[model samples]
Target: MEFFKGDKIYNFMGKRLPFLGFSTILVVTSIVLLLTKGVNFGIDFAGGTLVQVKYEKAAPIDKIRDILNKTKEYKNSSITKFGSDDEIIIRVTTSTNSVSSDLSDEIRNVLKGTGNFEIRRVDIVGPKVGGELREKGLMAFVLSLIVIMIYVSFRFEWRFALASILALVHDVTIALGAVSLFGIEVNLDILAAVLTLLGYSLNDTIIVFDRIREGVQTSKESDLSKVVNESVSRTLSRTTLTSLTTFFVVATLYFFGGEIINGFAFTLLVGIIVGTYSSIFIAASFLVQLKFSIEDFRTKEVEKIKKQKEKEKMRAMFEQGTV
Candidate 1:
């Protein structure tokens, strides 16, 4: 059950700086790619046609693809088995100018010989809807970041809030860069994965921040860097264990969740690893450069209580004066 023992706890703090520097470089490079090339948005954001067809018997993807490829109408078609092997969802790229009778005729002909399958369903996503979803996704992501910053700032310090946000950005950038470099399609499913990663990465960062805050409260005279190191060490096992469990689940989904969920699972798989790294190396290291001290914690809490008591005393004095 135990992954690591007590002695190894203090070992990582020694080489933390160089590891952090390397992570920073990787994250920065990823950001550059994201800003320029951007993500390959899928049908959910780009708007396309979704068609479902069910066969009398289980059908193979290649066979269905070959039939569709015969017609120039489906040159850009994506063929995959649906929930049941007998069902298939064929996605053909469609535009306002690209819609044609020939494509529909060809699809019907292909399914005629295969089975008693009919057009199970048809949904057309317009450009306007896609554009709106794109805007909404961006807004949701930005708002989540703002909320996280405010919460972290109130709970710990401004420096920690900033560090946590930076780490979230780092995780997102690297995940986006991965999609770009590897040519992964960014669909609605993958967008969900990205949001999930944001939350998961933030959770990891908060765990360390929480530990750092506790250390600051309990050890009044310890060095901030040493306290951060201790905090990181204390939570190392938990982070590793949680990440490993997530990795196993995502890996299973990637291997067995079928083509539809493959991209989503892959995105999550990469995000989990990158998020873990940023939470530890990138986020924790930021504390070293920050002007952090245990006294700040004590002063803020003491000052707030003092101010409250002073306001109460002033109210009492005002009441007596009025009398």
Candidate 2:
């Protein structure tokens, strides 16, 4: 349990300011990058054609891509392997602003191979659907933040509420910025992953805050910041171990979760790492800076009971000494 008997490093707390500064700088730089080079939204956001085809045997992905690339009809198309290397999905931009059944027939003709194959699915999403999805995703993210703020404020205090929200926003912005930087396609699944990360990050923060709260109640003689530092130090082992275990699982998904869940797991991996850092350095440190006091911690009824007990102990000691 006592992984770190004393503080791991005597002057470890001083590095917090520099860490905060670097995080702030990175966030600003990411924002600038995003503004200059916006997110490359996938076909799920921008409307396009979708075609899923399965082969009897393992198909040559490069050959399929070459076929799409050489075809005059789908000159500007993005081809990807879904499910497995044998299953191919293609998306082609509309030329005449209309999605015709004839277009699917053309794609089938181009994809017609020597081996046995089956067209599994085909659908065309319009710009209207993309717009609606974008709106809904925005609403979901905004609603999640609002709910988190309300819950943290009601459960803990306003300072903690603000700190947790800031951490969540930081995690989200970084994830989005990373996806944009990598040209990863952001879709409905990715948005769902983002929401899940928000909850996961907040759960880590709440656990650390709860530990700090416990320290404040028990360590009456220690400074509030010291109490917080101790609490975080004590929970560091649990935090690191939990994150590593989760990371291994998510890393597995990232590598082999297929194309569909890969983006989701990638988002999760980044969120969990950053979430752990924020819980320790940002969230707990901000609470200490906010002057979280033991007095502010206890309820009025508890304080009254404590004072009555102290008075009774003092009276008993006085009577025994006089006798």
> What local lDDT does model 2 show for residue 314?
90
In the range 191-294, model 1's lDDT, one tens digit per residue, is: 89999999999999999989888888787656777787778878888899999999999999999988779889989999999999877777877766666667
**Candidate 1: 10-residue stretch with minimal lDDT:** 4-13
lDDT of each: 0.80, 0.77
Give the poorly placed runs of model 2, Cα more than 4 Å off.
1-12, 53-75, 80-88, 95-97, 102-104, 113-123, 289-323
For model 2, residues 112-213, the per-residue Cα lDDT tens digits are 863568887876777778879898889999999999999999887688788788888887887777877887778887898899989888988899888877
- Reference-based TM-score of each model: 0.79, 0.79
Q: Assess candidate 1 and give its TM-score to the true structure.
A: 0.79
